[model samples]
Target chain A: MKSARPDSQGHFGPYGGIFVPETLMEPLRELTRVYKVAQKDPAFKKELDYYLREYVGRPSPLWFAQRMTAQLGGPKIYLKREDLNHTGAHKINNVVGQALLARRLGKTRLIAETGAGQHGVATATAAALFGMECTVYMGKVDMERQALNVFRMESLGAKVVAVTAGQQTLKEAINEAMRDWVSNLRNTHYVLGTAFGPHPYPMIVRDFQSVIGKEARKQILKAEGRLPAAVIACVGGGSNAIGIFSAFIKDEGVRLIGVEAGGLGIVPGKHAARFAGGKVGVLQGTKSYVLQDDDGQILLTHSVSAGLDYASVGPEHAMLHDTGRAEYTYIEDADAVAGFDQLAQWEGILPALESSHAIAWVVKNAGQFAKNDIVIINVSGRGDKDVQQIAEWKKGQSTK
Target chain B: MKKTRVDQKFAALKKQGKKGFIAYIGAGDPSLDDTVDIVLRLEEAGVDLVELGLPFSDPLADGRVNQDAAARALEAGATFDGVMNCVAKIRERSQIPLIFYAYLNTLYARGFEKAMNEAAAAGIDGFLILDMPREESGPYRKFISAASLNSIVLITPTTPEERMKQIVKDASGFVYCVSREGVTGVRDSIAEGARGLVGKIKGHTRLPVALGFGIGTPPQAAEAASFADAVVVGSAIVNKFHNNPHTPEGRADAAAFVAEMVKAVKAVNSPL
Candidate 1:
């Protein structure tokens, strides 16, 4: 009867809480209550399932990377192809679930915070499908670096607001989104794109995204006739990693590893390696490990992949890390770029720089596994959104 | 029993047939010395209590004025120790009931038990952490209550009746009744529903309820005091400092602005 979760008050051990303003406490509590009712409603379940299959193109394939296994000379790497999902990232799964709830709540607008724009695109896509107005708050700097995603999000009918606040990154984006939610709580639903934030958000997002792990578990059993030896995914706010890892945490034989962005190195502001540089503190509502300074200001984070650049991980991840249920490690930005190139060359699959973090970990530790052992990597997003940035990065490197 | 400063102030205000008025300002707006100067000036201006806002990088619940003041403080070398040091200076000069108006991350980052002890030792009489809800406030409440510091709770218009009961049950100091359904800012009119919300909270707890968030002008604060036991003026005072340069001149300007607000608050008929 062991359950690793956010408890009744939405705490996962010392992490996770409804740390919000009084204006938001009611909404968070209400959302938590409604989400519980929605879970048991047969009609609600049917509608969610229908949209998951028809609208989002769910049950994304589990592909075996034959060439990658041969090149690495280790365990068979099974790719749980989340990149094949309709919005090109696993972000769509959570967005679709939240959109359904928004519709039920009679919300007319759906708002979100985006970093690399994958979540914005996914949120925008779901908003369009649900015929709800969408606004996305992104850091001004992020909007510039992720211009293509900005365009894609705009094209999908979301109003992309450039936040010119502190640090101008995902952290600021979230702050802006929270401000928006506080002002327009009645008619709006802030579709937080990750498995962070306060109560119900972490729980709701994890439940929606558990499909990845559930699907991969059945698919892996069929492909290898047994559970994989390990499961790996990149951890930002830890949505995708938790999505895949939730299904495997109980399986004692299955090793769960979350790869964090190592950026340049562990020199203070050089990385988003929360496990390496973070201290246990609260930020963005939930109590988790955070990269903060002595003055309690959240420090600027660095990751070549915009999506993986975050100061904190999910509360559940904090709990897991504390209990020794999951091991989190780091992959530097240069190594992730190298992994991106390797995946493209070997498997003809250009991985998103975010997902490439997991791939980098896979290649670095391939020697640790046996030939028959299997390791499944959750390729969280397609690389079309990253190609322009990657090309620009290469140009900058050549000039150097 | 060592009556906490918050309780003593409310009781005295109650006996005097006066409505409470708490003035909020960032601890290091422009510089720490100005902050110490401003709090002392605020006491002279008739502010019953001072809520010294400790700035954080991400102030999610603040409006532009408060946010800008925080930015200025942070830019001017504001740190946790620095703000606390400023509070210690203010304590030496005055005993106006002082509360550290801050976010959960700022306090939690400082460590729960340590924050309570240091806050108390540094002359903070109470706390109104902007983010930590009652459910997550167990450790915070435990530590602060044991140290005999007031742990104020925030209540809003949207709070369900059942949840409000739960929130007030654990509430030690007065409940902060949000005057409007928005972040902290200056508004021409208070929430039209302010009176009813105050009445609802009054039914739940005997602790004095202070309405804040958008109670900007003197008339607005007066209107709010007509119903609630206290009216809070934060952003408007912060706005005075916000619009001016973060200098001694700016601090003087904001202090003058707070004086006007105090005059108006002092004029309010004490319904309590």
Candidate 2:
């Protein structure tokens, strides 16, 4: 059966439509047309496959978490090792696909917006490999916090523009990137880093990232001989989650769980959990559950992970939450930190703080599952970028 | 259709054989009182239309000037109802054609139909929603006409010729033709193809075309007015008064600058 989602107009049940300025409309339309053709071309598939295997180190292994499962005394747990991919995250999967699409479209330049800098570094690596000029717009605050990733981006020959507007965060960075795209649309391609934004983007990014789910589906069957009882992933803009969820959506028995950053608590301005505290509103070119005030002004969000500190979640997640097809919960910052420590000690894996939220959810709810039941947790990225911040957190905790 | 103040004002300008001058500023930039005072001053200075920007947290189509102005407005507690109240306060004295230049979410959040009714009641004549293109304007347009408010549409430099027809078909008030291929900000020169774009749009619709975006100075406004039926100056005018003290003298200082732009635009002998 054909999946009837994000219908032709790029809407996912009244969410995810084009809400950008008129100037960018034509360019978006053109990109949509180009991508439609590129998606079906065998040559395009062959090229992307070659790069995924040789360049990005694709088909990231699925490792069974023996130590964590034994310690938690619950379901058998497996980690989808997206953290081991080149550039140390799953972002390169989509970036490599889009960079190839940009080349096919005859575009010579690339631009992207990044929050935690994983996407920025991935995009920069693709641009360097493809020999195209690249620019990344990042918030000034994010630049300060993700300084190593910032340096990594710069070393790959991408110019990182520090946006100082509106809390100096991911939302403002997206606004600045939109401005830059509108100003220079002739030969530039905006490689939107998330499964967000208006039409074509949510679809395009999901299709490229489906590799994660596609691989995990095959690898899990070979190892466990059946579908996992549930799949868990961290929800930032919901890219990595969507990447893994796309393959399991048709599996009626597989439970999909997305963990949002609970930040300090569920209080106003204290968290980035949109489903818990947000309303239906549009922001940054898509209509979704946005953390906004009654006046529709986006509320400032807080999260220990820079990547998850966005006011809006991707539209597909909004649709999923509404349809009750997936389960969404939240983990507080302190709990996520504890989860991070648990993984590094038990599994010997330093999970990204964003992914630690997912691990934290399993830690709290593992007792609800049978011992023979299997679960998959997407290790979306490595924690090298977050080590410094965690050290600061530890120092502050000791002082307090 | 009931004639809005925007329609009447445009008719009066056409009868006078002169182009219109539109000034834009973020509503409640410093305070709601300052916005009311500044709007009346704009009318006195010969501004044919006042586009009060309903500030949004993320205004992607805007440049540094408008973005900062929005920040200041939100910082000063500029809520949606508060901005409409500022419009009502302006209506107490002046009858200048007032249109809200805002992004879509500001209206959609409060319920678009309710916001439209409130705006019409508060004397807003039309809307120039920066992000709501024709593809997404269906529901909003229905509410706009139901409330007797004009749905002002936008055509940009990047808008292809074939797409212009669909954009202007259900449009009212006037067509806002972007002067360049970028966000709203001041530029040293008017884009080369702006006049041609206006001429092309005229081929598709009977509506008056107002060239905006990047037309900051009086000379630039004059240059744009020479080809189009009206000129819109936003960032340059917003930059003038956004930093001034929230007082009558500051309002007058800003109005004086608008008076220069109005004179410049009105002096142009439109080729139309």
Candidate 3:
């Protein structure tokens, strides 16, 4: 069998490369070589598999939404319950894998940036489990909104520094984390939260998280006795979307749809819908489609969900978008709100505000497919944390 | 020929036997009108050179404080045209030496020739594109020098000998030797590497070498002045905006910050 190692430079068909600072070049090169070796090492795979089975509660269930199917009056809707994974999202899968890699590489500290606090919580959990010192940088705004997560990370013995610079959000948090890594490059490994950032990060994070698709493929085949007609996931930095799409990218029969947060609307400056309004530019150490001003200053993006408010999508998403291997769509705040309430009332599933974008897209387009066609939405995270926001929005809706 | 204000200011500093104090502030921060007020106040507070930071979102070399200030400037409708117009307005009132400090993308977006021409017309004296170093300075230096504006280069402690030689050869006005590897900020003391970096730059050129990044206190400024001709303080001065009361009291507070920083610099080497 051919080795599953990525190309020499870590490219997944011109999608990945080492776009990091000079300080990280050697470590990243070492990591690239070691990751290839580790993938084949039975010990490493066994350890990873053990964690997936026993720790992260892997083989997450595939639930068929009967009410959703009846409401759609078309395709049956099924969801891959990545939301049930340890740390409440698909992000932990990659974090756990990377943390193991960090230990193997002799790194003693972990640093990361979090938007909705999902990645930060996941990283903090992994670091605590691996007995490493963890430092997470979060935007001041996110720190305020995700106060519970801040306490959680601190309780886990990770230092949660509130970044007040730039837009006081995820992008700025990443900048501060990168600055920290650059200064402390000798002993630290930056656990990037998404399938973005410089070259090896996108590739490594994707490879580690590809277990989602691998598991989903087998589970879906076993559950449905065939491949689903469509696969859907929300795209923030496109991690979960890529995780689910990677296995199906080569499967020409499967249709991949990535949903972006449309915020209030797809107006030029209102939303974080990069696929709809962004142009090719560089931000957060990678060249990709970014929502920026004419001078290339990354703009302040808004979304109901903190995780989906990034101004740029992942570079792999950009390449896949350009190549037409995947289709991208948008879900406005109103649509996502409806989807959030609908998923809760109909399926007893409170999807993450980020993942709700995918749900919203599926709901809006449900009528287009035939009754026999099946759509598998990656329920990327649970929405228990967003209850307050949803309740406030509901009150406002009633008042209006 | 009309005497350029920068030359006049430099000559005065040279005569006074006092090292110049250069302060950087993001143009159009908070608001463009307020930035103009801040600039004028900084000039009045005995700042010799004012470096106007052109706000860019991804300022790779700036710390969080400066980066946030840049974002506020951009959000307040500060554009390239708006910044140049602010410079022109300040020129109409004062003759202080002004330098446009920015990332290369801003300069590239405005087109080098257009930026230089507009800058010269607005009484701007120098250019410090933070990310562009000596190797990539050819095209920018040609246009800036041709337009009679100085091209200032940054020298870090990690900069090697050959690169230092190139920087000094291409540099005009002064050489800004960053005290540390990271972005601009106020730190406790000058790095141990700064003195040696200053000595290396002095070996190459007679142009003034200003030590910047992390020079916060009078004692630190004094220590830096012992080696270089000028001390650059940015974050300490910008921090004033963060704490300012946004009233006349705020302006007073900002001036006080500048006065104290200047006093510290002057205490190192008094004008004889």
Candidate 4:
């Protein structure tokens, strides 16, 4: 067997590694070994391809936003519409892959933590399909905010446990999930929502989700007759961004831009912009650029989008930032709100709040690109869930 | 004096031919004063060690019961300093080993080095940062060792063999082995995998390995003790606090519940 060295050890340029207890060592090692073998199996690939093509509606269109691009007078903006997927987001692509691997490993139950409910719903959907018992952990505050998704998950036959601890959000939910996994290791498989967590998880989730980039690569070339000058995706735990960027990483000329949530502003304790204001630290099973206080405690992060409110970016994104393979930037809440309004008014599309961070960045820099340059923005999910919050925020703004 | 305490407790358990029972409770669950009383009660009930859970807004590894305890503790105005003071109060009455169970952020917010120093001074015997494991133990371990405070590491059934060896090498006091994968709760039976897991860990080091997460009754503790050096009961005891639902009477009721569990543990461990 090829050694599970280098990547499995969690040393992604000081970003990733196993920071878990001694109890989790065997399961994680077993997972690493199984996943490594499954990745190369033609049958696994064929099965995943079937799911992508038949179930998820893969090869989602790459459409040029003509009106917006013409108005900006910088470049033609194109969108990779992952929102068109069956679950209305790119999250299911990764969940389906991981769930299959879990079954192969003989795990009978599925557990996950959610921020925006996208990953939770996707996991629940997969679990129901695969006949696995599913449990999802969400912060109490998130359970209240994303009530519709709670119903959706429950309807899909999954138990939604409310985590009331810590910032009452995604990070805390993840911690609760980890604790759950530690206690239920016998028949349970933790379907991590993103490309973060301990070693192999970051690498494994990214590899599974990379189908986004793989399909986008072929479609973009077919549509535009050439590869675009840039690819942009919003980064939370950075699964979507990495998924789209991985296929293009070897392409020398394609610039990858990952936009992080810059809630209110970059002022300390106000945002989740790990690259903009965070420092190196260990958090939630991995070492990455974490938004922490001087004492190294993770600070409470704020963002208009629940999905993007994470203190730590994915390890690979941190590695990418350090290696200069990708440029990381931040988009403030006001700017993202503006992008949401513009996308709704101009393109007849409502982007997920998480994806709006990328649109905000694109809108802010659109004037800089040459008119002939082509840019592809990953429209990660549909924004229906954000309508209520956005409307409330706008109403508050109008009243003020 | 420190050496004497460790030696005496070790000797006591050795003579009993059974592992010790460590019970965890959220400090200041219903109120600070009541939490102090509960700790003393637990110690008197024959608990070998008492784990004082420092309430934080975000306790990542806890189940709903423990999460509610932390919330109530925070609601009762249990800050990091307040918890430290509670530990100080517990120190006045008990010499039973005390471990502070918390997330790394709380310690990090107070500054790890400062937190370790203050915790040691507060009469804390050990520290268990729930979210931090052996892989990120560098600074945390060094600071804890410098303060002469034991850093108890958790071992899970899923932990890899090589990493388990590494964890055993770095662990102090004893190793906390999670019996299952999900969060803390009272289950009907010990997981089938835990016996083999204890055997694997025993092959690694001489450090006392304590089985935790699902142990709730005397029989469960005794069953686990047959193979392990200690058994930990947390959520089961915390559930006692919930029976009263945040009332002063509830807190008192919770203390009585710990006393009952301690009685159960002692029944199994006591020489006939």
Give the alpha carbon lDDT tens digit for every residue of A1-400 in model 4.
1111235486677668876655565677788988988988999989988888898888788878988787678688998899889888999999999998998899999999999999999999999999999999998888877788889999999999997666789998898788888777889999998999887788888987898898889988887799888899999999999999999888868999999999989988799999999888777777789897654556789888889999998988888898788999989888899998888787989999889889889899986677889999999998987888888878888999
DockQ preference between candidates 2 and 3, better one = 2
Candidate with top lDDT is 2
Listed per candidate, the RMSD to the true structure in angstroms reads 1.8, 1.2, 5.5, 4.2
Chain B only, TM-score of each candidate: 0.95, 0.97, 0.95, 0.91
TM-score, first chain, each model? 0.98, 0.98, 0.95, 0.97
**What is the per-residue lDDT of model 4 for residues B144-205, given as tens digits with 9 covering 90 to 100?**
87888777888776677777888788877888888987677788999898999998998998
The lDDT ranking, best first, is 2, 1, 4, 3
Better structure of 1 and 4 per TM-score = 1
Off by over 4 Å in 2: A1-4, B244-247
- Tens digits of lDDT, candidate 2, B52-142: 9999989899999999999999999999989988899898899899999989898998999999999999999999898888888887789
Report the error of model 4 at residue A89, Å: 1.8
Predicted candidate 2 versus true structure: per-residue lDDT over A1-400, tens digit per residue:
2353688778988799998889989989988999889878999999999999998888899999999999999799999999999999999999999999899889999999999999999999999999999999999999998999999999999999999997888888889988999999989999999999988899899889999999999999999799999999999899999999999999978999999999999988899999999999988889999998888889999999999999999999998888888899999999999999999999889999999999999999998789999999999999989999899888888999
- lDDT, each prediction: 0.88, 0.91, 0.82, 0.83
Q: If both were scored by TM-score, which would come out higher, candidate 2 or candidate 3? A: 2
Q: Fraction of the real A/B interface contacts present in each candidate? A: 0.78, 0.89, 0.15, 0.62
The true-versus-predicted C-alpha distance at residue B146 of model 3, in Å, is: 9.3
User: Comparing to the true complex, what docking class would candidate 2 get?
Assistant: high
lDDT of 2 at A63: 96
- What TM-score should be assigned to candidate 1? 0.97
Superposed Cα deviation of residue B141, candidate 1 (Å): 0.9
Q: Report the C-alpha lDDT of model 1 over A70-157, residue by residue, as the tens digit.
A: 9989799999899999989999999998999988888999999999899999999998987999999999988988899999999988
Indicate the DockQ of the complex predicted as candidate 2: 0.89
